[model samples]
Target: DAGVTQSPTHLIKTRGQQVTLRCSPISGHKSVSWYQQVLGQGPQFIFQYYEKEERGRGNFPDRFSARQFPNYSSELNVNALLLGDSALYLCASSLEQPRGNTIYFGEGSWLTVV
Candidate 1:
C-alpha cells in the first residue's frame, strides 16, 4: 500500500491570493489531518476529518479550511494568503483504533508567498 501523498510539492503565490492543496491517505486509513510548519518550529495543527466529517480544527484564521472526500482523500484551502502563511503544509492519515490513532505524515506541500 502506498503512503500518504500530497500534491504540488512546491508552490509560489502572492499575498492576497488563494491556494488549494490535495492529499490522498493510505489505503485503510479513515482520518486525515492538516498541519502547518514554519522552518524552525514544529508543525501547528490545522484540521482533522474522519469519515468525511470535520472532527476538529485548530486556532487558525477563518481563511483556512479543509474537507475529506468520500474516498478519504482530503483538500486544504487557504484564502487571503499572507507572507506569514508561507510554510510547509503537511497531511497525515491515521487509523483510529482501540489503541490510538497512529498518524503518518507525507512530505508536505511547500508554499511560498511573495
Candidate 2:
C-alpha cells in the first residue's frame, strides 16, 4: 500500500489565503492515515482505519503500532526507542477518506530518540 500523498506538497503563504491539502490512500482502503518522519518527507503512511478497526499497515517494523480510543483519539506507540524511530505522528479520520478538504491534521506528537 502507498502512503498518503499530499497535494501542494510544499506550501508557502503569508497572504492569509485559503490553503487546501489533499491526501490520497490506496485503492480498496476506506480509512487513511499519515505521519511525518523525523527528518524525512512531508508525511508517510502509517495505517488505515476501516469500519472503526485498524486496517492496512505500512513498512514500519513490528516495533510500531497504533491504538485508537473511544474518545476518537489515537496514539502511535513505539517500543524501545531508536534513532530511526523518531517521527511526528499525525492522523486523519473521515468516512469520506478521498477528499483532502475534509482531512484535518492535528498538532502531532513528536518522538525523538537519543
Candidate 3:
C-alpha cells in the first residue's frame, strides 16, 4: 500500500497569504496529523483528525487547522500566515493512537515566508 504523501514539496509566500497543504494516508488508515518543524527543531504537533473528527490539537495558533476526509486523506489550512510560519509542514498517519508509535511521515511541504 502507498505510504503517507504530501503535496507541493516546497512553497513560497508573502507574510499574509493563506496556504493549503494536502496529505493522503496509507491505505486502510483513518487518522492524519499535522506538524510544523522549524529549522533545526523537532516537529511540533498541530492538529490531528481521525475518522473525520478532530482528535487532538496542539498549541498552535488559530491560523493552523486541519481536517480528515472520508477516504482518509487530509488537508491543512493556515490562514494569514506569518514569517515565523516558514518551516517544514509534515503530515503523519497512523492506524491507532494517531499519536501512536506506528506513525509515519511524509517528505513534508516546505514553506518559505518572505
lDDT of 2 at 76: 53
Count of residue pairs whose backbone atoms collide, per candidate:
0, 0, 0
Instruction: Tally clashes: model 3.
Output: 0
Single out the weakest 10-residue window by summed lDDT for candidate 1: 93-102
Misplaced by over 4 Å in model 3 are: none
Name model 2 segments beyond 4 Å from true: 1-34, 98-101
Each model's lDDT:
0.94, 0.52, 0.90
Tens digits of lDDT, candidate 1, 6-75: 9999999999999999999989899999999999999999999999999889999999999999999999
Model 1 RMSD in Å is 1.5
Could you tell me the lDDT of residue 106 within candidate 1?
97
* Better model by lDDT: candidate 2 vs candidate 3: 3
Per-prediction TM-score to the true structure, in the order listed: 0.96, 0.59, 0.95
Candidate 2, RMSD to the unseen true structure: 11.7
Candidate 3: what lDDT? 0.90
Question: In model 2, how many backbone clashes occur?
Answer: 0
- Runs in model 1 with CA error above 4 Å? 97-99
Model 1 pairs in collision? none
